[model samples]
Target: MFKLLFLVLLAASVHQARPDGRIVNGETANSMAVAPWQVSLQTSYHFCGGSLISPTHVMTAAHCYQRFGVTVHFGSVSNANSPNVFDVSTFTQHPSYSTGITTDYDYAVIKMAQSASMNSNTQDIALPDDTDYTGQTAQISGWGQLSGSGGTPTLLQVATVPIVSEDACKSQWGNLRITDRMICAGGAGTSACMGDSGGPLAIKDSSGKWVLLGNTSWGSSSCTTNTVSVWSKNANQLSWINGQMNS
Candidate 1:
């Protein structure tokens, strides 16, 4: 989690539920048709978000991996419950991931103990290619918050905003480097903050299919501020993800 305390050292910029909160200016999604791949990472309560990439695997942020028990809830949009639930069979964090002001390689994958049943209500999202996403509208969803303050909704929240260019993102972030392996979206008013770590940030393809582009990692130091949120670009780690999922 990014700590306000982290401003002193490095962990200061990472996002979380306590201070980072959830979606700002988003709508409640109660149907799977909206985010069929959405996965709520919970430990008694929703702590983070994720996306189903395959029947047996999920994509999320490295920091979301926990040694404690975590229930993966999906197949529904309700923040409180879902028809699908799984105990983690594996939690694979990227080898290079670590928490810092410039959190690098923040992506990770989770393997379910049992494969998720495929249906209209429950499905996996397609992975992204290296194609440019500039100016494309990115839809990010989570079970975090509506207004910034610490409160989660009974339904999932989603915000749609255009992807920002690397240069512009770098410019806004100032000294912090915006690497090629990352993707930035949400600026000005609408953004995906809250406790949205590991949630999916996607764009509809020409066919109107949702393609997974990135996973929520960190955002501005404050959620209420109109700051750009960052994600672990999926195109940069397709090989590693496939390898891990197959293993």
Candidate 2:
């Protein structure tokens, strides 16, 4: 599984200054529409991100954890808030994770020392049972910054994109090696970018539950550019995700 490169939004340079004055291409906002406790993984020392999957487990790109020591934040999206930062006790990247090549199994989970407390504002999203998300429209929500040149939003941002065929995605990417473990979303000129990794790609299931179908992964540099999202929907990995969550 290839760790997608973090693309910093170009707009962030104007609104805020990162610690080292390094501009990251992605941004996110704090919004009441999303659960208040839905956390974004961040670090004072690193650039990658992660998502809170359960009260205690965070699902994120394996490389994000490997590259930066795992640290999860809850209750608030800003670093100013006093957050409970827990070191990852253990993590399991897909056994076939590849360093240089993009693979369908670019997913991993981190277990924290203690479980997160649940409330109306903090809860775990459900996961789909199988790879049955053929033509469903899903909503991806994140506090990640917007665009490669913008500032992170103060409110959580939510976008709706339809699921696309893997074949079509491969065609868009000049027939790159798109595997069954992945799925594509966004339009010809819209998508998720940096700081959005490990976020949920959720759709309403047959029971009307917002079940997670994919985790935010790599895409093109710009939202206006055609981008393909690599997901963890491959048969074996999907099973593992469900099994880990006991879904």
Candidate 3:
């Protein structure tokens, strides 16, 4: 989760409920079969994660912004070899998003400067759906850190976590109120860590296609296991995303 807009987008803002970019207790991913739509949002280095929603469009967290520019890299699990890259043609965050917290309207859209090259390992994920997904399991992936102080992985890392009930999710968040716009997941050894902001938290649909459900927004300060990670819900943002990304 992307913790908060915390200053320059990637520093201390990540608190008890902060934006993060890591996969704890996750396995090295064979991303082609499991996470083809995943992309590393890089600028000098890998800073965040995102999902391809169309050949020229992407979905990410608003807090993953860079003042200069960002490049989208994909088509391979190993970050060292991801050959396809594209400059952003446009970057749009929900108009109502705030800086205090990276929850609610923390989502954003990115348009590649040109049509992206798609292949067996590089493709688009399903557009978001209307389902609540409160009790279902979803997959989380990224090239962020392996732990709070661990080295970031060169290969993609993935973990499956069950979405926590909204009530349970809120209770766990303590002072940071869990809004309807935030979907909660991960309360076990598997959790997200720093650098995983703007990444996807998704589930397979009836057709077995991964559908975007949430965007990593924030997590615990230590990114320890058993801490629930928060996501920016996608269902409520369908109209907003469809209208803005196409505009």
Candidate 4:
């Protein structure tokens, strides 16, 4: 059911494969929390991953669906054990997505033909509302391998990191343009890596609700090292996301 294979291309010098590290089970850390039944989008065709954002919608990096026949599985933490699989019915890459830059807007939404069944183990995550994530700490989760060398973890893995400013990210990346269309977070040598892409970069809202601030984007070559994530904080994009969920 992968539909847009022609569009997804690997970024040059970008470490698209998972890294080698010890298997760390999911846990709560600051604003990061793992949702039950969240699955990683792994298939023979592509090495990237995604998260189940709702009963019918899965949030992932737009680059992950560039391959045809890519399959996604839910209800399991390990890639080998996940038997509940679904075919993507529709793929929607953000209209502004471009691969020209190092981390150009890389978010996308996938619609499955059937709705996912939610239980205590599985649930939809809340989206952030007009909240400034700058200077706030966030968490990211994924079932992908610990490092490029380690196998996919048997349980979900999560890590804590603080958000960075666009100016800081651009200064670090040098030539790349860190625009207002994106928000960055990381430092203190803790960050998300290859397998964490398209996952949630979340923060707590004023109401104590865990709202998604960023879809895991690219980062440094390693996870334990300092990393920066590009987030979507534009008002128009936030409204568009709310509209999608409500509609």
Each candidate structure's TM-score, on Cα atoms with residue i matched to residue i, is 0.90, 0.76, 0.91, 0.76
The Cα RMSD in angstroms, rounded to one decimal, for candidate 2 relative to the true structure is 6.8
Candidate 4 ranges beyond 4 A from true positions: 1-33, 148-151, 222-224, 231-236, 239-247
Ten residues in a row with the worst lDDT in model 3? 1-10
Q: Residue by residue across 58-154, what tens digits does model 1's lDDT show?
A: 9998877787798899887785768988999898999988555466687889998999999887889999888898988888888766655556676
- The residue-by-residue lDDT of candidate 4 on 1-247, one tens digit each, is 0111122223443433122112123343222125452456655632555556678887766655554576667665555566467877776777767666444556677777778787655566665566666777776666545653445544566766677766787666543445666666765655555555666666667778766776655554444354454544433276555555555
How big is the RMSD of model 1?
Answer: 3.3
Off by over 4 Å in 1: 1-21
lDDT (Cα, tens digit) per residue for candidate 2, span 1-247: 1124543222322211110111122224443235443455656633344556678777766545454465666655453462466766676676666543344466777777788776655566665676557666766665555655666554455666778887777665535345666667765344566555666676778877666676666655544334445555533465676566663
Please state every model's RMSD to the true fold in angstroms: 3.3, 6.8, 3.3, 5.7
TM-score-superior candidate, 1 or 3: 3
Q: What lDDT does model 2 reach? A: 0.55
Task: Indicate the TM-score of model 3.
Answer: 0.91
Task: Tell me the whole-model lDDT of each prediction, alpha carbons only.
Answer: 0.76, 0.55, 0.79, 0.56
- Best candidate per lDDT, number? 3
In order of listing, the candidates' clash counts read 6, 32, 16, 13
Q: Say which prediction, candidate 1 or candidate 4, comes out ahead on TM-score.
A: 1
Report the C-alpha lDDT of model 3 over 1-247, residue by residue, as the tens digit. Answer: 2233342232333435555667888988855668888999888888889999888888998888775668888888886677888898888888987655335578899988889777888778877677667778899998877776788888888899888888887666643457767888998678877887888898988777779888888877667778788788888788888886678
Model 1 CA lDDT for position 202 = 88
